[model samples]
Structures are given as C-alpha cells and as structure tokens.
Target: MAQVLEFRLPDLGEGLTEAEIVRWLVEVGDVVAVDQPVVEVETAKAMVDVPCPYAGVVTARFGEEGSELPVGSPLITVAVGAPASDPDSDAGTEGSGNVLVGYGTTEAPARRRRVRREQQVPVPVNGRSAAPEVVEGPVPVISPLVRRLARENGLDLRELTGSGPDGLILRADVEYALRAAASPGRPAPALTPETTVASPATASPTPAGTRVPLKGVRGAVADKLSRSRSEIPDATCWVDADATELMRARAAMNGAGGPKISLLALLARICTAALARFPELNSTVDTAAREIVRLDAVHLGFAAQTERGLVVPVVKDAHARDAESLSAEFARLTEAARTGTLTPAELTGGTFTLNNYGVFGVDGSTPIINHPEAAMLGVGRIIPKPWVHEGELAVRQVVQLSLTFDHRVCDGGTAGGFLRYVADCVEQPAVLLRTL
Candidate 1:
C-alpha cells in the first residue's frame, strides 16, 4: 500500500523564514529519488535548490511559480511505497538521511527508481482506496501569510475560488473576499491589471505607477539598510587621495605579472592591512551585552550590484589572502553574484565591507554600513585632477575614499585614523608593501 507523505519547504539557514518558488523540477506522478533536488527557490539570502528526502511518486504540488511560501509549508506530497507506472521500476519506501537544515530523515533509502512521468490517481490515506464520490483534500494554499490574513478576517478560504495558478489561494483573493463581504449591497470593483497582492491597501483600482513587490533581494537590501540606519549611530569621513601611484603600481605589476591583479583586489588588500592596524574597525557591537565584540578573523565583504539587486559576497579569511588570491576570489564571487548562484554562506558573516561604487561613475557616496559590520570603505572613480605633487600642480589620478563607521564602536579619532591609513595606501601603494 502506498502512503502519501508531505514534504514542506526546508529552512535554508541564515535565519530565513520563507522562500519564493522560482521553478519546480518535478511534477505530479513523477517518480523521485531520495535527496533529489525537487525545486529551486529564492530566499532573502540566496537561490537554493530544495531537495526532497522521500523517494516516491509525486502526488501533488502546492504552490505556483513566483509565489512566496513560508518555511514548513507543504511543497509537495509523495506516495511512498507506491508501485511505479513503469514495469521496470520500483518506488523506494525509505527516506534519505541526507537533508537540508530543518528537515531530515532517520535512515537512507534503497536504490532510487527510474523516474517516469505519468498521471496517476492520488493515493488515499491509511491504506484506504478512493471513495466513489469525489472527495476534496486539503485547501489549495501555499503562503502562510495568505492563510493568516484569511484567519484574522474570519474568512473561509475553502468557500472562495483562487485566481492563482493551480487554484492556489493568493492574498489578493482573500482581500477581495473581505472587501466584497464588507459592503453587502455595493458591487465589488473589477481588479485592474496593475492590482497587486503585495498588501491589502494596494489591492484596489489601478494606480498611476507600477507596483513592484519588494520580497526578494530588493526587500532584503531595503530591510538591512533601514535597520542599519535606525540602529547604528553611524558617521562618515571622506578624503580625496592621489591614486596615481596606485595606478602606476598596478600597471607595473600587471606588466611584469604572472597573473594580473584587479584594482578591487588591491583595495581589498589595503583594507585588510588597514584593519590589521586598526582592529577597532574590524569588530561588531553586542547590543544585548553592551560590549564590543572584536573579531579575530577578517571575513571581508565586497559589494557587487547584479541584475537581481545589490549583494555583498564575503571572502573568508581575507586577511590571510594575498592580492592575487583576493583578485581571484573577488572575481569568482562577483561572477556568482551576477549569475545568482551565491550560497547563503557566501553572502554572510562579514567583519567589514568594501564598496567600489566607482564603477557606477560616481565621485563619492556616504554608504550605509552593512548591518552588524562596524565599517564600510567606499571608493569613488579615479579621475584626473589638479594636485600639488612634489611641490608642483599637475594632473594626477585622484579618487575619493569615504569610511562610514558605527559611532557606538569607536570615536571620530579612530574612524579618521582608519580612513587616513586607507587613503595613504591608495596614494602610495608602497605603503602597503610594509604590511605585505
């Protein structure tokens, strides 16, 4: 007898609570193997392929693509121990012990069966066959947020027909039902094309502008920046430095180099050295304990803007990496960020951040510090400018360096010293050689 087992969205770690379904790999009646990736989802942190622990025939899927589902919501149901549609295959009953965080099984299953796609009747519960009369199973809903909204308004989801794909109830459906119930005699207004379920307030007539839901990478960035502004007492210090020497040193190194080094890598190398000198900036504040937590290792994070949104990929043990190594790691991480392949582990745990907004062709910016990190170094475009070099006014390559530091961690003196050190390294690349 086949036993149907429900598989919910597993916790992708990094304190994530929900994920948006990007794509589904398996369909109804398709045989699945233990620990096989069944779906790809995008969370606040990164894109993750969710694997199913059970090996069996997929009976049903709960959500549509692009719909947000809270953690632990049913993703799919599998009929374990079910006979495969293919005569040559057999559905395994045991679950795979290998699983993601917040989900796992006790033992590994036997050899996986060959996956075959065929529509099959849903298996009944407790070894009972389906009755002659059509029986409705659980309500078709994916998002817990939608369920909560319906529950709060005392609305019955089963009574309302869902407008989303696969008859999945959406937040807009609940809101529309609530509005229709509130006014008994009045006819409910037609939903326009621009109507969005992002919030109940926005589920009305078409607005003048388009409403983009901030639930993915954009939402994460917004939340982090807002929290950083509200919680951190931050201060910014800026300085214009002559980067002519730095550029010349880079050209010289590349000209004679085995492997070319990137300018961002040079800046990162300088940052690690500066952090070594000023360890105060390489720490985070423990607000709960009212103590400053100085980090021993420098997990350097560099900001990279991608099609998805702004992301900061961290390089582990950055202090121990040389310029070439930093260049390679930065390149790899930037590629991952651009392609949306960065893992949750790659996107977090940074003691300091380096923002190269110069690529945006900007001269300067007061960057908001990445939360939990004490400081961020922003580099502006290096352009030709008049400077007093060797007591002569000449056109020299100049770049603006800005440091935004948490005032709770250190005073202006410490921040200013750190900024000055970075600027000195930028002005005279040889200044970094001492630490190198």
Candidate 2:
C-alpha cells in the first residue's frame, strides 16, 4: 500500500509567513519527481516556485489559485510507493532532501498528521456556550495578518463567515466586522462576492469607488511607508546641480568602453563615495538601544517600479564595486524586478536607497526615507536648462539632488554637507576621483 505524505508550504525565508497561490504546476494524480516545482506562489517580496519534496503520485491538492495559505498549510498530498504507468520509475517512499526553510523530508511524514489530529478538539467560541461548541479544526483562516487584525480588534474569528474560498477568512472579513461594530446604530452590511471593507473614515460615505485590499506587495509598501512616517523624524535637503561634466564624462567613457556605463551606476558610485565621507548617513537608528548603528559596508538599494508594485533591490557590498559592476548588477536586478523574480534577500538589507525618480519625468520629489535606514538620495531628471556656467548664462544639463535623512542620526549640517558633496560630484565629475 502507498503511504500518503502531505507537503505543507515551506517557509520561503526572510520572515515571510504566507503566500498566495499564483498557479499550479501539477495536477492531482500526476507523477511528480522529487524537487519538481509544483506551484508558483506570490509572497509580499516576490513570486516563488515551491517544489515538492516527495517523489510520488499526487493524491490531493489544497487551496485554489488566488487564495492565500500560511507557511505550514498543506499544499499537496502524495502517495509514495504508488504504482505508476511506468512501473520502473516508481519512487518507492523516498523523498528529496532539498526543501526551503521550516521543512525537511527526512523526518517521518506522520508528525504533521499527528499534530492535525491532536488539534481537532472541541472548544467554546469566545468562551461562550459549550452547548454549540466549535471544533477547533483548521479554522477557515490562512493569513496570520488576518488573524492578528481580528484579535487586536477583539473580534472572534468563528463568528464572522469568510467571503473567501471554502469560507476562508480574509483581511476584508475582519475589517468589515470591525466597521459594523463601530457603528452600532447602522445595520450591518450583507457580505457578498463584491463586498469589501473600507477604512473607518470612509466606511459611512458609501462612495462608488472600488476598494482594493492592501495585500501582497501593495500592503507591504503601505505598512513600510506608514511605519517610516510614524517612527522617523526625517528632514529633506535638495540642491540643483549642473551635470554637464558628469554627462560628458559618461559619454566619453562609453565612447571608448567595451561595456556601456549607466547614469544610475555613476550616481551610485558617487553615493558610495559620499557615504565614505559621511558615514553617519549610512547607518540605522536602533530605537530600543537608543543608539545609531553605523554600517561598515554600503548595501545600496535602488527603487524600481514594476507592474506588481514598487520594489527596492539591494546591491550587496556596493562600496566595493566599481561603476561597471554596479551598472551590470542594476541591470540584472531591474530585469528581475520587472519579471517578478527578485528574491527576498535581494529586496532587503538596504543601508541606503538611491531613488532615481527622474525616470518618471519628474523634476523633484521629497522622498520618504526607507525605514530603519538613515537616508535616501533622490535624483531628479537631467534636462537642459539655461544656467550660469563659468560666470556666464548658458544652456547646460542640470539635475536636482534631494537627500532625506533621519534627524536622529544627524543634524542639518551633516545632511546639507552630504547633499553638497553629491552635487559637487555631479557638477565636477573629477571630484569623485579623490575618493576613487
């Protein structure tokens, strides 16, 4: 007899707790090889292809596409040692050792089964009547975030029926319940396929606007930006610089080079050089410790907007890389971001961010500092404008450089000095050679 082994969704690392099923690579009863990617899941960070560890015939599948599942939720069940059409290729109760974080196939498969059986005990709903007891089986909730939202608001999960697949509770369900509770005079809105929960302020207006649930990449961005605004006392300083020399230097180098250099790479090189001079900008403030931790190496993150959402891909050890290497890594990361293939590691650990909003055709913006990191350097569009060059009015390429820094780390003098040095590098490219 074939032993059925359940494969739960393994942790994708970087503290990701859940993922949405994007697409299923395999179907039930399909013979899958060990380590074969069975499903593609979209986490907050990136889209990942989760591989099955067991080599056998798939017996069952869980969670439909577009539905979110927690890290330990069952993905699929495979019958190991099952008879196959190609009898010689049967895996015979073997499992691939290769798996992501939080799971291994070497252990006996009955562990999870035992745990599931143990959790099937009956419990009273909110310590209410035991006559109508609620069996604590798999609660129709997957996302821990949804559970937390309901818990924090003192709402019971068992009371509200979920609008998701198989009555799965979503963030919308919890929010809708909270809103209804806040306004006791008004009748609770009926939950439907199209029902969505809006913010408390906008709950009563009943506007005909479509409500998009802030989940996945959009939700992550919202949370990070909100935290950044609440915690960091930030200040911005900007300066308009004549970039004629920088443009000329780039053109000359590309003209005589084997590999073309990117303007962003040049800006990053300048940033690393500036950080060396002002190490204060390349540090994060640990609020609990009440100390500013200065980072030794520069892990530069550049903002890249993709169809999924805005993502910042960090270039590791950026201070040690030259302009050419930075250009190549930026290209690679940007392409990955566009294709939604960037890993969690690539999307985090940014000591400083270089926001080149110039690509959006905008001249300037007061960029919000990426949380924990002390500073962000924003580069505006480089365009031809009449300016006083060599004490004469002339048409020259000019750009605006904006630096937003955490006030806790440094004062205005340090921020202004850092921005001034960056502008100097842009106006006179030779100034960068001093540190190079």
The C-alpha RMSD of each candidate to the native structure, in angstroms, is 11.2, 12.9
Please provide, for model 1 over 135-205, each residue's C-alpha lDDT reduced to its tens digit, 9 standing for 90 to 100: 34545655544654576467766676677887677878887888788687885654332334443565776
Candidate 1 global CA lDDT score: 0.82
What do the candidate models score in CA lDDT, each in turn? Answer: 0.82, 0.83
Which run of 10 residues does model 1 get worst, by summed lDDT? 112-121
What's the TM-score of each model vs. the native? 0.77, 0.77
Over 4 Å off in model 2, which ranges?
Answer: 88-90, 101-205
Clashing pairs in 1: none
